[model samples]
Target chain A: MIEFDEVSYGYGGGPLLADVSLRLAAGSFHFLTGPSGAGKTTLLKLCYGELIASQGRVGLFGEDARSLGRDDIAMVRRRIGVVHQDCQFLDHLTVAENIGLPLTVSGRTATEEDLGELIHWVGLDGQRQSRPPELSGGERQRAALARAVVMSPDVILADEPTGNVDWDMSLRLLKLLVELNRMGKTVMIATHDLNLIRTAKQQVQARVLRIASHRVQLAGADL
Target chain B: MSRALAILQFLAGDAQADRVVPPTGFTARLTVFVSATMAFLTVFALALSLATGRLAENWSDALAQSATIRVSAPDGQVEDQVIAVMDVLATTPGVADARALTDDEQRALLEPWFGPDLPLDTLPVPRLIEVIETPEGFDAAGLRARLAGEAPGAVLDDHTRWREPLVRAADRLRTLGLVSILLIAATTGAMITLAANAALAANEQVIRVLRLVGARDAYIARAFVRRYTLRALAGALVGTLFGALAIWLMPEAEATGNFLTGLGFRGVEWLWPFTIPPLAALVAFMATRRAAFATLKERR
Candidate 1:
């Protein structure tokens, strides 16, 4: 769970996110919608303790994010999976290796069968042996998603998971996220794509929060 | 103790952990080459230090228990003064033996400078007496007084003034060699740190990716540290082997006691060079660990 009470963040010019208060409860799905440069990714970063709030407080797992040590933050991160828009992967690693990275880094081993199952689930079985540079945009995104969830984290924060993929691939990714939600894992996605939000709304009980004018507000049933 | 065990465990390493960072050819080569060069120099430094230490010890011990006496008198009275000096030495409590060097012995001592054909009878060369002392040596002051009373032309040369400076020089040489080794180790550390920094910078994306997946700074640092340490170890091992082989192949020391001929390991001293590789690895481990953590903290 993540809680930001009156949290504000800025990069010295002016406030990017100001006077924001929100709570992500356990087993909940959230879609953060905002125009470009509206602090959607920044909010996600604050939730994961990647950036300390410049004012007020951001709490992760009931602990103050600002007060937690680097090691403590890393441990907290093990419970939260993040999928970047660009699908960051070690470019030299094979798809299977990249997907198994979360478990490996956490000092755990994933059996070949389990990793293979996850790879197949991500529709990356054919590209398992290919390096990140050799993969298509959709393949990279799915690989990134597989890597994020290999540890079976309690929360998944995805930023523009479908930005580089086609519509069919986007739906496939959304279905995977929905399946994860059905298994009781909390999911939060930040994107400007309204159709994805509408599609996710019908399949799962996801709340829509839109960032505007440097504040997060819950969008009404208009969508 | 637990910390040491933790370091050992870290050194034992994980195959999976090592695969996280892609192999960097340039930094890898830089570390290995620097380690090898430094380690090669270290072997020589170690050899020089050990050889100088032995030389100092040999000079101190050999000179401490022996001395010399020179009799310079009128040609007719030289034999009498030598006889008196010998008698005085015989009565000394700790004088093990005293013998006047024959004319042939004196000629042989000066053979290198004056040539073997020098006319000893014509040149008025002073007579020399070699004095060997017991473990508890005779007091030079007391023996000097006795010789002055009996033989005015006789001078006691206890060899202190000559031996002290030589022994001191050898000891200082040994210390200098040791200091060189320390400096070499420090230089190796600095070079490895620079290489590690470059590697860390080059692998910034890898670090970001690792951090995103919940890898602690220590986990990431270990990946780099283990690689650099192993490279340094392997390079140093090869360098040390080559260094030791070069030393072994040098010409053996002759009876002339030339320092250059003796500049090598003897017996168990050969084991000293073997320690360089592990020491290089330790230096690499510490340097890489520090750089990795610093870079990670900066990124954070």
Candidate 2:
């Protein structure tokens, strides 16, 4: 339930995203497609209230993102999980600890059996005790996904979720996101891989939005 | 997610999670060293204040309940003046004890300057009477009037005027000691703030990762606070121990008839200096916490 109406963000030099109006309804799935440096990540950030629009308003959970204080933004973030392109993680933490980070930060505890089940579900059961620095790229992406969904957020915003993964591992990560969407979580993923987007369509109904000329538009491309 | 998984996740937000970003070991040593040195100085300042307080109290008490009645007359009249002064002291209700100084004792009072042998019969030196009083104290006006009427040259010295200045001097020393401690605490806060800022700046990437994983500002700050506070506490503890030992090791005081002899803690008063470590830790916590929350706010 994120909405961007006439939202434009820009660095001090000039507008990177100009006059972009978009709405993400509840329980929907979308893939943001664009070439490198096309402001795709920036748009995804606005959706999650990470970077507020410099020129226009981005609303998260129906509140103007720019008007919210840091604490309010944190509350918004707690409801919208984010997975970065780099699979950002506390590297000093073990893979299992990294995956369960969201819950830990919120002061909630997890049982060994529950963590074991989640780790096995992500195909990271063998690497649960390994630190993020020790995990392979595919494991890192899956760990990031586990962290994102661990909060049971209403929305999952992922920027280049499978960018560092092998083809098969990419498919697995995509399937995980799709499964989350099927469970009634709204998902938006920024990716340059068209085949992965097409692969996602076979399992779930997902819209593809392309960013160009500082505006968001429904892509003519389909799976 | 299950409650167990959530708990594990939150615990991961500790400083150990960001251990991948190395703290400048030299800086840690520098901070701990600096804080320890500051704490050491603070301990001395505290000791000075406490010692001066005791000195002032002792000086004030010693002077408060005593006075001197000096008799200056011809050699033969010395006995007559002393007897007249004793009569005057006897009539004073609050006078506890009055004794005439023996010739040897009186000569010893001037021995520091005049040496051991003094021909007092040839000299017109005044005869001194040592007078002690109860807590309520004798009426100075009544004794002085009687002395003036009988022993015209006898004068009563309550020692109040000189004692007031001595007490005030000690009071000023105590105030200076207190001010020094406050300054030391301020310095510690400043140094810790800088160190915290530096650490936060160095670990920008660590913070980003933590935030990406849904770590709150409060969670991030707790990690730093716990680290810095513990460092300050430990450093201060070592500093205090060294400082107290240094103070205790000072050579035993010599009787120079000077009030500075008791310028160190006595007996159970030694426990006061130990409080500085906790105080230092508290200061570190507040300083680093402020820097962290401010930095995180700017990051957002």
Candidate 3:
């Protein structure tokens, strides 16, 4: 339930994303496609209240994003799961610890069985105790996904979830996301990968939004 | 009171929360070393202040209830004036006791300056009478008037002029020692803050990861704060122990009864040094919390 109405963001030089208005309704899956430096990450950031809109209002969960205090932002973030492109992880933490981080930070405790099931679902059962630096790229992405969903958030915003993986690994990650969506969780993924988008269409109903000319437009069937 | 309980709750942290941030070696050691050094110095400052306070009180009490009389008359009349001063002191209502100082006693008082070989008989030094006062000291003005009437050459020296300056100097030294301890605490806080900032900077990626997972700034700050506080506590405990040992081993003041020799804790005062570690921990907790929150906000 994130809405951006006529939101414009920019660095000091000029506008990077201009007059972008979009609404992500509950129980929906989305794919954001654009060229490099096209503000895909910026849109995700605004949606999560990491970056406030410069010209227009960005609302998260029916509240204005700009007005949320730091603690409020943290609470809102607990309802939104974000998987970064680089699959950021604490290098010193084991894969299991990283996956359980969201729950830990929120003052919630995940039982061993639940965490074990999640790790097994991500196919990281064998690497449970392995640190982030020792994991493969695909393993890192899956670990990041596991961490993002550990809190059972209402919305999932993923930026280039499969960018660093091979086609098979990408499809496997997409399958996990599709499974998550089938369970009624809203998911929005930003990427430039067309093949992955085509593959995702076969598994689930997903709307494709393309960022071009500093604005977001609904992509046609040709994509 | 509620705030202190909240701090205690934070200190009793979850194992999972503490595991989020990786252990940093250099900053940890730096904080411990700074805390230890500052704590050691703080113990000395506390000792100095306490010792000076005792010295001031002792000097004030010893000088307050006593007065002296100097009989500066011609040689033939000196003995008569001394006898008259003694007789007048005997009738003084609040006078505890009064005795004329023997030549040997006068010589012993001046031995440090005049040397042991000086001939007291050949000197024109005034005859001195030591006066001890009762709990309710004698009225000096009344005694001076009586002495002038009966023995004009006898001068009442109540020792106020000499005592006041010594007490004031000791009091000032005590105040300066307290100020030094405060400055040291402030410096300890500053150094710990700098070290925390460096640790936070080095762990930027760790912070980013934690934030992405919905960790509040307070939660993140608690991780760092708890760590620094414990390190400071441990280091300060060791430092205080060594400092107390050093002070304990110093030569006993009973041998000299000199001010320098008495610059240490006495009786119940020995418990004072034990407070330093907890104080150091508190300083570290506040400093690290401030630094962590500031750094987190800045990065955001």
Candidate 4:
């Protein structure tokens, strides 16, 4: 769980995000939507302790984010899986190696059976030997999802998970997130796709937060 | 001890950890080349230091053991003065034995400068006496005073004036050689640090991915430290072999008869250069670790 209490952040020049208070309770699903160049990515980074709040407090797992060391932040990150818009991957690694990175880096060995099952669930079993650059946009997104959940993290944060995919592929990706949410994992997805959010709303009860004019607000039920 | 053991454990890392950082082509080659060159120089420095130490010890031992006395009397009185100088040396407390040199001995002493056939007896060459000192040698000042009174033509020359300066020079040269080795180590560390920083900067995306996936700083640092350390070790091994070969191929001291040109190892001294590779590896390990941690902290 993460809590931001009246947090205002600035990068030297001026405040990009101001006086934002939000709490992500256990097993809840939420969506963060904003225009490009807004503080969405910065806010997501704050949730994982990548950036400290310039004013007020940001709490991660009930601990002050500012008080944690890099190692402690890394430990906190192990429980919070992040999926970026670009689907970052070590391009030199095969899909299987990329997906199993979290376990490998944490000194835990991933059995072939477990990795195969996870890959197959993400529809990437046939591309296990293929590197990241050879994968299409949809395949890359699914692979990133598989990697995110390989460790069974407590919370999932996705920044534009369906930003580069088609309609059917976006739904496919959304279905995966919904399935993960049904299994009691807290989920936060940041996107500008209103149709995807509307589609997501029909399947699961996801609260929406919108960032505008340097502050966050709970969106009304206009959609 | 535990810290040392932990460092050893870090150095002996797992293969999975090493795969996190992609193998950088340029930095890898740069590190290997620098390490090999520095290690090659270090081998020579080590040889110079060890050789100078042996030279100093030899000179000090050979010169401290014995001395010579020269008698510059007229041709008719030179033989009698030589005998009188021998008698005075025999009664000295720290002198073990003394003997007047024969004509043949005098000729052999001058054989290098003059030809072997030089007529030593024809010239008015001063008569000489050899003095061997006991462990507790006689004071030169006291012996000089005795020689002056007993045989006015006799001059006691213990070789202290020339020997002390030569010994001091040798000691200084040995110290300079040791300082050169230390500077080589320092330069190796500096080069490795620069190379590691370059690699870290180039692998920014790799670091970002690893950190995003919950890899700790130490885990990421181990990948770099291990790579550089192993590369340095391998390169230094090759350098040391070449250096040893070069030393072995030099002219032998007996053949050259010049101590300065004889900069190679001797007998068990050859084992000394074998340590350079491991030392280079240690320097690489420390340099890479420091740079990696510093970069990680900066990124954070």
Please state the CAPRI-style docking class of candidate 3. high
Model 1 accuracy (lDDT, Cα): 0.92
Which portions of model 4 show Cα errors greater than 4 Å?
A: B1-12, B260-262
Residues A46-76, candidate 3: write the lDDT tens digits: 9888898999999999999989988899999
Query: How good is the docking of model 1, by CAPRI class?
Result: high
Quality of candidate 4 docking, DockQ: 0.84
DockQ of structure 1: 0.85
- lDDT tens digits, residues A1-223, model 1? 8899999999888999999999998889999998999999999999888899999999899999999888898999999999999988998888898999988998888679869999989898799999899988888889999998999899999999999999999999999999999999999999989999999899999999999999999998876
**lDDT (tens digit, per residue) of candidate 4 on B1-300:** 999998777667787777878989998998899888887887888888888888888888877878899899877888787778878877889888888888898888899999899887789788888888898888999989988988899887888899888889888988999999899889989998999999999999999999999999999998999999999998899888888998888887778886655588878888888889999999999999999999999976
- Poorly placed runs, candidate 1 (over 4 Å): B1-12, B255-257
Which scores greater on TM-score, model 1 or model 4?
A: 4
Write candidate 2's Cα lDDT for A101-151 as tens digits: 667666666557657777887888889999888888888888888878877
| Estimated TM-score for each candidate | 0.96, 0.87, 0.95, 0.97
Q: Fnat for model 4? A: 0.75
Writing each residue's lDDT as its tens digit, candidate 3 over B1-300 gives 999998777678778888887899999999889888888898899999998999999999999888899999887898899999999999999999899999889999999999998798888889999999999998889999999999999999999999999999999999999999999999999999999999999988888888888899988998899999999999899889988988888888877668686798989999999999999999998899989888988855
The clash numbers for all candidates, in the given order, read 0, 14, 0, 0
TM-score of chain B of 2: 0.91
**Over the full model, what C-alpha lDDT does candidate 2 score relative to the true structure?**
0.84
Q: How far off is residue A211 in model 2, in Å?
A: 1.5
The better candidate by lDDT, 2 or 4, is 4
Predicted structure with the largest TM-score when compared to the true one: 4
Weakest lDDT window of 10 consecutive positions for candidate 3 chain A? A105-114
Order candidates by lDDT, high to low. Answer: 1, 3, 4, 2
